[model samples]
Target: MQRLLDGIVKFRRDDFENHRDLFKSLKSEQKPHTLFITCSDSRVDPNLITKTLPGELFIIRNIANLVPPYRETPEYVSTTSAIEYAVLSLGVENIIVCGHSHCGGCAACLGPAERLNNMPHTKRWMELAIPVRDRILKEIAKDDIEARRWMMEQANVVEQLKHLMGYPYIYEKTISGQLMLSGWYYIIETGEVFIYDKNLGEFRLANG
Candidate 1:
């Protein structure tokens, strides 16, 4: 807690002072260009990775960075609502669903049932990745942990992109080229990001 407080103090004294004008300009409204959705992992810093400034990337962080198919319901819908607001209200041009290497959520999705049985809510949330788990298991050997993990992580990103298209507005915008959707697989240790290439039918290094 003290560390967090000290960081805040340092930010106010240094970073904040340096970016004072930029922060002041954003006091009223924000117009972000992209909707960046990724895992709520401590190591994955969206802004740091993308080199985006404040008010540039509207972000949504979740357990597995999952996006449930669009549905109208009275129940609380945090992720769905954020997606709607980012696209409809904020008019974000791009939507990036980023899944990383060595994701605990992805591992949990591929792990034994006992791994998540204790957390009912998380277990239920992870149900969205069940198809991913099933598909990867058939494609890779059970003993090949690394291969399975890579497939599971990248497959989950692709799955969420499908879910995003289920939203009527998102689908329309995407098809009409008004909105661009991308699925990215980030390798943590190597600092490499592979983007899904629809034409190639696989993820390729962002530059390569």
Candidate 2:
């Protein structure tokens, strides 16, 4: 906590003071160009990874970075609402669903259900990745832990992109070429980013 407080003070004295004009411009309204969705992992910093400034990328962070399919339910829908606002109100042109290597949420989704039984909300939220888990289990060897984790992590990004398209407005915008959808896998240790190529049906190094 003290560390965070000290960082805030440093930010005010240094970073904020250096970018006072930029911050001042953001006071009234923001017009971000992209909606970046990713895991709520401390290691995965969306702004840092993308090298985006404040008010540049509207972001949504969640467990596993899952996107539930569009559905009308009488339930609290924070992620869905953020998606709607980013696309419709903010007019973000791109939506990037990024999943990372060695993600705890992804591991939990692929792990034994009983392990997450105590974490009911987390368990339920993980259910969103069941389809990806099932596909991986059917084809990948149970003993291949590394292969399974990597495959599931990439597959989950594609799965979330599908869910993002399930939103009516998002679908319309995408088809009309008003919005673009991208799936990215970030390798935590290597600092490498792989982008999903729809035609290749695989993630290729972003630089490639």
Candidate 3:
């Protein structure tokens, strides 16, 4: 906590002061270009990874970077609400669903149910990814744990992208060519990012 507090002070005295004009401009309103949705992993920093400034990317971080299928209900839907606001209200031009290597949420989905028995809410939340999990299990070999994990992580990103299309506003914008959707797989060990190619049906390095 002290470390974070000290960093805050330093940011106020240095980074904030240096970028005062930009920060001042953002004080009144913000017009971010993208809605970056990614995992809640501590190591995955959306702003740091993308090198984006404040008010540049409206971010939504959640377990496994999962996007639940769009549904209409009286229930409070945090993630769905954010998506609506970003697309309809903020007019973000793009939505990036990024999933990273070694995601605990993905692992939990792949592992035995008892592993998450203690975490009821987490277990329930992961139920959203069961379709992805089921597909991977049926198609991928279970002998290689590493291969399964990697594939599951990448597939989860694609799955979320599909779920994003379930939202009416997102679908409308995408069909009209006003909004673009991207799926990204970030390898933590290599610091490499792979973008999903819908045409190729695979993930390829961004530079490649």
Q: List the candidates ranked by lDDT, beginning with the highest.
A: 1, 2, 3
- TM agreement with the true structure for every prediction: 0.97, 0.98, 0.98
Backbone clash pairs for candidate 1 read none
- Tell me the whole-model lDDT of each prediction, alpha carbons only: 0.95, 0.95, 0.94
TM-score head-to-head 1 vs 2, winner: 2
Model 2 CA deviation exceeding 4 Å by range: none
lDDT computed for candidate 2: 0.95
User: Over the stretch 81-192, how does candidate 1's per-residue lDDT look in tens digits?
Assistant: 9999999999999999999999999999899988898899999999989998999999999999999998999999999999999999999999999999999999999999
lDDT of 1: 0.95
Per-residue alpha-carbon lDDT of candidate 3 for residues 53-158, written as tens digits (9 for 90 to 100): 9999999999999998999989998898999999999999999999999999999999999999999999999999999899989888889888889999999999
Ranking by TM-score: 2, 3, 1
What would the per-residue lDDT of candidate 2 be over residues 65-156, giving only the tens digit for each residue? 99989998898899999998999899999999999999999898888999998999999899999999999999899999999999999999
